[model samples]
Target: MRKALLALAITGVALLGTATPALAHNVLISSDPADSASLATGPAKVTLTFDQYVQDADVNQIAVTGPDGNQWAEGPVTVENNVISAPLRPLGPAGKYTVGYRILSADGHPVSGEIPFTLTKAGTGTPAKVDAAKASGAPAADASATSSPSGSTGIPIWVWIAGAVVLLAIGLTVALRTGREPSQEKTKQ
Candidate 1:
């Protein structure tokens, strides 16, 4: 019984140690347009800078929504040296442009947010036309919905706790079985 209890305690401590390092997540440090800044001209590209290195995955995305609710961001999002950026197709219908981005953190978790910037003057460029069905589709929208808050690493805390509980149960079972076998042998002697 004592051996089983000790084993379970050791397992619990090991789990806590492993979970501690995974608690830190990438945080947004700054952006190109600067959140809520009023600009005379549209930026050529949208850039997001994070405090820690971000994962360069194909899943990274950036969408610029103009006043007409049309998507203005162009090209695929690129990541380099903790920075994620996407080109713009010239902005039109200047009013408020919302920049929404979803990037994978270094630890394989998605982080997303929106930055709103006002365009002081209208641009000559036209907004990119997107199909209503495709625009409202799953891929782009799901990334933001799936992301956890800033401080959270990725998975929920309960997931870690449940994993630790399973490990403790296994350790206790093994320790008790081994301890019982030795006692049984000694009694037989």
Candidate 2:
């Protein structure tokens, strides 16, 4: 009985101690203009939505490869909700464009992938130059949603409480099991 109780206690402590919350990567769920969609005109901005929020505190860098091999995305990436986007000046000669993005997920790990879309018609706007302000600055979007989904590190308060609880449970169990039968022993003597 004692051994079984000890094993259960140990198992409980192990389970509680090795608790790793479900920290997952941000999977791209959908995108505006849809991947490889043939659009008649260019969109005002390119947006990528993810299954989980991407960390936006740190700059998320995305590369836009145009049909002409030119870059169209301007400035730093902005994230709102689970969407990461950048401004697009205009569309070039109608063709396919690929946007590649590498962003820090809420888990603090970097997640990256490439998606492409085609333009059915030509747009007559130059790939606008990145403005110095927006270029140097990240979007004024949700700071937390853009970063790792997992809250930053260092022992959480719950961890300390868990440790205390486990120790207390172990101590109480030991005391109850080992420190009993005092009256029985005295009567036997």
Top candidate by TM-score: 1
| Model 2 C-alpha lDDT versus the unseen true structure | 0.68
lDDT of 1 at 115: 85
For model 2, how big is the CA root-mean-square deviation? 6.9
lDDT at 95 for candidate 2? 89
Cα deviation of 137, candidate 1, in Å: 9.5
TM-score, every prediction: 0.71, 0.61
RMSD of each: 5.2, 6.9
lDDT of 1 by residue, 35-101 (tens): 9999999999999999988887766778888887778876667899799888888878769888888
What ranges in model 1 sit over 4 Å off?
A: 1-9, 131-143, 146-163, 170-189
Evaluate all candidate structures by whole-model CA lDDT and list the values in order: 0.76, 0.68
